[model samples]
Target: VNPVDRWDGTPLADAVRAGHRQVVEMLSAAGAELKLDVSQTSVKLCDKAREGSVEGVRLLLDGSADVNAADYDGRTCLHLASATGNLMMTRELLKAKANVNSVDRWGGTPLADAVREGHSSVAKALLEHEARLEFDEVKTSSELCECARQGDINGLTMLLTAGADPNACDYDKRTCLHLAASVGNVAVVKRLLEHKAIVGAKDRWGGTPLADAVREGHEQVSELLLAAGATLDFSAERDARELCESARLGDIEGVKLLLAGKCAVNATDYDGRTCLHLAAATGNLVMAKELVAHGAGVSITDRWGGTPLSDAVHGGHFEVAMELRKHGAELKYSRLKTAGELCELARVGDTNLIRTMLAVGAEVDASDYDGRTCLMVACATGNMHVVQVLLDAKADPSVKDRWGATALADAVREGHAHVAKMLLAVGASIDLEPSEVVSRLCDYAGAGQLEHLELLLNCKADVDAADYDKRTALHVAASAGHLHIVEHLVSRGCRVDAVDRWGGTALSDAQREGFTHVCKFLEGRRQLVVLKRSSSQEQLNLK
Candidate 1:
């Protein structure tokens, strides 16, 4: 009842819709008030009222449910009841002091709902309650922002005419005019300008409407703002400074503009760090690539005597380091090293250095001082790219570290399903005895890795593999709500009714964990299995 669903539908609505009168009565007695926000189409009370359930409506009203709670779309219970042509429900709502002229999200009142839904009696009843025939309603600033977002000029006018603030700022301090200009809503922009919306208003991000238009490539919107006294404000020294700042902030838009205006790509900031150096330090591959394309030298050293490639490697941007290498930036860190250095590079995701070491006859399966192999370190650190590189070099995933854990175990333990699947696919031996093999299968099943589970089953791993608590892979899959894995296990001849040590069947486990889809699947499979047994018994009797 407290944690509403994504649509903001409450538990009370669910009870009403399910016709659970007793639960509704209890919840009502607990003081569950009807509250509809912007996303709700209609409330549970309204849904009940629309179905002509007078008792349900009465129960809700007795519980102090507001008769006039409007959804984001502005549809109330009376509107729903009128549209649904539920005369008794409408009368009950009207009698409960429901507002007759409450407008919906679309600004239609209950009388309009009645008229449009072909309920003349409901319309007459609403008119009797002083309901207006015309469509009109006050619009809030939020509604004006929504109109601006949708490029709805007519909606903007209606809201403006109804006294909505032209310069109203939303939660983020973004005015309606800012939103209109961001999406290049020219008509809405002009309308807002006519209503005297502040042209120089800055949002929470310090971005004005003109800056937003320029950033988004809205040339017309930019020109309009410029004609309305917005300045471009690009100076030579400022461009050089902003270039490095954009590279540091990873602001691709600002960098692009500065680049298009022929600004120096290799311009140094006050600290003597060029744009390329900043991009490398920030590990922004796209920004680095853009800087490289604009003639920024990757070999250019910063004030601290670090090249862009050195900065990339030091910042753990192995991908950026690789890109710099592709552009002929000399590798400085690929010199010969002990097993410790290779392990360190692998741990840092320096795939290029690993490749270089391997090419120079360095052992691909070398263990660190702590007895952890490069493969184990990569898998444990959740570095999939480095893991793939080591795997391609034929590094053994079955090698145990100091604690007797293999790369496969590390991948599964770290929730790296892709890495675990790769290990299994590449024939990393699960050569443990029966019980340990079953435990490994349960790990993959628990991780919800359908691909890994299928691979394990193909590798002669038992489909009915169970862990320590007698929890089968089915129990694991059901608890985790992996429907596909559950179906695959059942189709692979795994027992449908296998119970764990807790005396819980897969169905019961799914139910306990609130995995509704898995519960339905397990229940359906169990019923089908029962029906087959019954049919077979019936045939034997006939024989």
Candidate 2:
């Protein structure tokens, strides 16, 4: 009698929610339709079923409700079933032609949901129903990830035997072996190795399984990896300093084994730092002596022309420094003549030893290849006592380094406000023209030294000085989201419209670096903010 009888509405949806099968059937016959578009309808059904209300789901299905109906976020009935791990309801929905691969707006499908949550039976059912095996072309079946994470050798073995790709990688190029090694699943790792999974396979950043094992301090896993013929000298990633890194960590046993396995004794890292350098830097007198005895080249100069002796002296390792000197390690070299030794001594506040070196005719004011004097090093290292000692020794404070940085510039660069004040008190000039003031200021701002920046500004440092790249301090501050610095620079009459060598404005740099706060600040100032198209814009837009 009612025209509304033909339309789906709340009463019939409520009947479905109540799980009253007879009432639901009567309502269906009376043409009381179930509302598919109601915001709470699908959610109620999902909630009922997830609460183990099997009758509710059956009644809804028999009434010809949308088997694949989605809630507000596009999570379908199967997604709810998988989430609740209701195997029977999930099987029934699959039999009714429910889309096994239907994903929420977040790209989470039934299989992904099941695997992520350890719904093993639901995951198996979905897989049997031909669910998509891979998610986003990189992350493999969440089932595999779960099994590896749980150390479930049996579950992992089953998945692999069921045609799961053992070699499938995650978004970070982390193969199953990487995950296994990370978790220290020795048995699972052995199985994977037996399956010929790439033992030396590198991840996105070039970390191998062995690297993972070592980093996590998994002793058994590390031993297994080493026994599997993983190259001891394998420098796959930032972990290239593997053996030396281990030694530096004081993994004496690990270091001994790695060295015994023929890792290069003098392998220099990206910084040209060797094992002996690290040992000396840490003041591990025993390790330093061991490395030297093992033929470590103590004389090998770092990128800064610093030897083991310099590292020891700089790190305050008097005993290690004495040991290195005993091994014929000279602090001063004719070539690459730098005050690295004196700077090292200053860094450790070793005034007595510094005087000893001076008494032995060590050049008190020698500059390095970069023309950085001991005074500049002292200022950069923020050691006030060392600065005073150097100043008293008649060290030149106004000398510029190869980078055109004076002692005052180094102090300001490192955000040592107290040290900068000390230098200023000693007649250090703050008005010298730095070759790349903008770049240096940008670096300092990026490091979050607002006080140091204030000091520079108060000294009336150039507000719009350009670096070699012609970028102003404003651009650097904007790019790095240093709002206070940007505000200060603007207050000091920095040109808001200045363009860098790349023709980018401060606003452009802010947007490029995704600095929303800086961008908003610049926009409020009515600055000409250019929106440049980045190569990764398409990807960002998709996200």
Candidate 3:
């Protein structure tokens, strides 16, 4: 019974595939063990279910085949049965203890697959088993839209009766009517009209169901929607503007309509910008591909003299930008120093985009027009993700901008202490001269940056350097009620007795600022010093 055929089909798998229910029962009685871990065994069960052999599936389950065994792609027999609309096979699998809510490696649950494959009965069965759904309403708008698109009248009625809003819209604001009209489902359209689905609803791009039908060349659907009060809402000038708007918004339907209407493929608006230009600028690769396929000029520049590829790169949309390059779009400059693009991406914390730019031959230390390196931009914006990626790419943290400030300087100046720690760890020098060290020390002390202040002290910065306001680290720390900094500075020999230009001693400032802890610490230190002096004088008298 364990012997395998050339196709690796065991006796049980072969019997199940051949639809021999009695043979499967006999094999189970004879103790022919199932290959639960073997991918081929699971594949055979799925294949039988996929072929709509309900008895074949039942036989396999009765013969001790694992109901939840999944194939290499993580799809169990239940998934296959549900996808193929085999309701009986699904029921048998579920009765055999199959997982109703199992998700595949691609995050597709059986319920999602069932709905997507238009298996309303199987979907209902899975829901009865408590299959997790993306929405808790009677049905998601996507499910309702799918039912209409596929002409499943029963599914549509079930969802609407269960309180799924007929007027429910998707992310692009397309309703069930829009989807039904787009696919030219006449009966579904009639059913949706009976349910009072809005006939004149405009999507995000102001395209109605009639416009959607026309765009898809569904003349019958268009006539039906128009008879039920759908409007055209399209003119020559409106088409040009809508094309640009749709391209920017990544609306594939609206772009297709403008293209079909023979609105010039290269039609330009007041900005002398074509749909390709808008698509590239907004990182809409779908619209970009469509425009290019319709013979939109890739090399054409806008009034600003920027081509589509240049605009894409400038917006840090490197994937779409690369797509443009694949279609022979010229680069405005060398790929070696795409600094402006890198800086923009770093500011937005797009580590993947920065990696893509570097992979395309961008220099790691490339600086923008303002001389700010990508690392500095990342540090200033507190994007630790981008900072880590730049550091891994061996970005030199020591490179200064036009202001002579390093990445570490920007991190410290911008109050990004964690970013400063990363910069310092990577050997970015904060080794300032004595004068600069004093200024920075005061800044750190006042801001309560304990770790950075400790690092500065380790670098031998003066503990008592006063700023232009004559405020030493102690005065600033005490005024800010930074108890830790006040204690650290005092330990490092900052003169607590010395007054600032404002005529305020550290203790006085602490008292005036209501820093009780700082006041107690300063008072304790003064008392200790006085007691030590008194002890010294007593010892001198004894001598």
Candidate 4:
């Protein structure tokens, strides 16, 4: 008979807990069995070892304890020993022939766990024991790749030398080289190169190692790969799109290298955006200047019929817009007067520059392709100071955007309470449709500013109004797990059972979103008998 009862015994557990090695050994000989149900076992000896108690660990292991046994959480003795830098325990486990590569439930190998815990010595020991690198185990490779992506040369080199498959593609077909290049890990790139790794390997998105390096501004890694004969134009199938993305990312060296390697600088993307257009759209002045200097076409327009100058101004690149204007760029497709000039100035919040533009006859009320006036953009961005300048310049604040949404609507929708207050003070209408008003209230409530929501309510905005999805402020507060906001909304007499367009009540939405507190509050208000009983029982247990 097992001396320890299977269901209700703690002899082995108690001995380990008390750190009584002699008692543990004697009990083991006298037929004390370790519970295989790890939740009840002395396998947690590793936890004691991690806390720097070598004797506690020795008691269990010497008693024929399973050295490779894991805790309830799948954390092995090695994981604990390695994480805590207990080299003696580590050596003992290695002697006991513990599986060096066993991982925890979290996919954390001893080496990875050691590195994470800053135990370099333990990590070195695990490496020497031939702990498998490049964790090909389904649950752990991505994290291991992330380590390589960070250019941990010691870890990377160890993994590579330990027979880790360097070309093992991740779920996205991204090889280790792809990660190294993306992070500009020059040394790791060189090491991978020595292993004869495929230099031009493409990821799931068809992004090559060179493309990733260039896209991320990894110039040194790019040079290294180039010297190793990695194809610069290997992604020629999507060269135009890739180059545009590179320009949009502000990669000057990548732009230069691609251009030098004979990528068509003026090649249009699927959206008809050229390298210059991407540069202009992102406000990359240096890249725009460089593209222009390299003979990139300035006349290319996007699908929306807007040129590079339009992109620059719309994205708030004043200097880039000016540069493009100096290059004779046109805003012919824009409805705004002096579109390039005024939008750029407004974008920078440069009141003085805007005044200069106005003095020189730039149009004050010019609207964009989207029918958005300077004041609308200012209000949308919550740049109240800029809105004041535009307003003083006679820019119409009442002008609606393409959505029939005015500046006040934009401010409220984006939770700019101060801007909304200013707009309301300036005689902006508060009599919006009930649905729109409630949508704005939800936006404020979602940002956790009950004060803003209260202000909207005080302005005579409807509290029970529903948005396009028929979601009221109560629904928004509940879904965001803001218990206080839920309480406030409920206290304000907002309907607790208000259902959305999908026929889901606020209580259902809260439960779906994992908002337990909101669910409890809503359930409490509903007087759900079971929930009330459960709450009472919980309170009694607590007492």
For model 3, residues 1-543, the per-residue Cα lDDT tens digits are 767767656787677667787888888788775554557657768888888877766777776767887888988888898888888888888778888878787666777677667678888888788775434323367788888887888878756653467888888788898899888899889988998999998888787887777666677888788788877766555565667777876778767866775667777777777889889989988888888999988878777677887778667788788888888887454433477778878888888778756654568898877788889899889888899999999999888777677887777666677787788787787545556767888888889998778766654567887777777888878889999999899888888776788788889988999989999999998788788889999999999
- In model 1, where do residues sit more than 4 Å from their true spots? 1-139, 232-254, 258-353, 356-543
Name the top TM-score candidate.
2
Give lDDT per model, in order: 0.74, 0.74, 0.78, 0.75
On residues 39-87, what C-alpha lDDT tens digit does candidate 2 reach at each position? Answer: 5556765666677766777777766677777788988778888888889
Per residue, candidate 1 scores C-alpha lDDT tens digits across 1-543 of 445788766777677656688888888778664455423424656767667788877766665566777766677888888888788888888889988888776777777666655566777787788786443222245666777888877656755653457877776778787888878888888898888888888766566787667555566887788788865454444455657777887878767865775667877766667888888888999999988888888787656566787777657677887788788775343222335666888778888777755653457777765567888878767898999888888988778776667777666556666777788888875444567667767877888877666655655677877777888888888888888889999999999898788788889989999999998888899999999999999999999
Better of 3 and 4 by TM-score: 4
How many clashes (backbone N, Cα, C below 3 Å) per candidate?
Answer: 3, 1, 0, 0
What TM-score does structure 2 among the candidates reach? 0.59
Q: Estimate each model's TM-score.
A: 0.37, 0.59, 0.42, 0.56
In Å, residue 118's CA in model 4 sits off its true spot by: 6.3
lDDT of 4 by residue, 191-257 (tens): 8888788887878888778878877777898888888888766444466877787897787877777
Q: What is the lDDT of residue 483 in candidate 4?
A: 89
Predict model 4's lDDT versus the native.
Answer: 0.75
Model 2 steric clash pairs = 338-368
Which pairs of residues have clashing backbones in candidate 4?
A: none
Worst 10 residues of 2 by lDDT: 526-535
Q: Please report, as a residue range, the 10-residue window in candidate 3 with the lowest summed lDDT.
A: 132-141
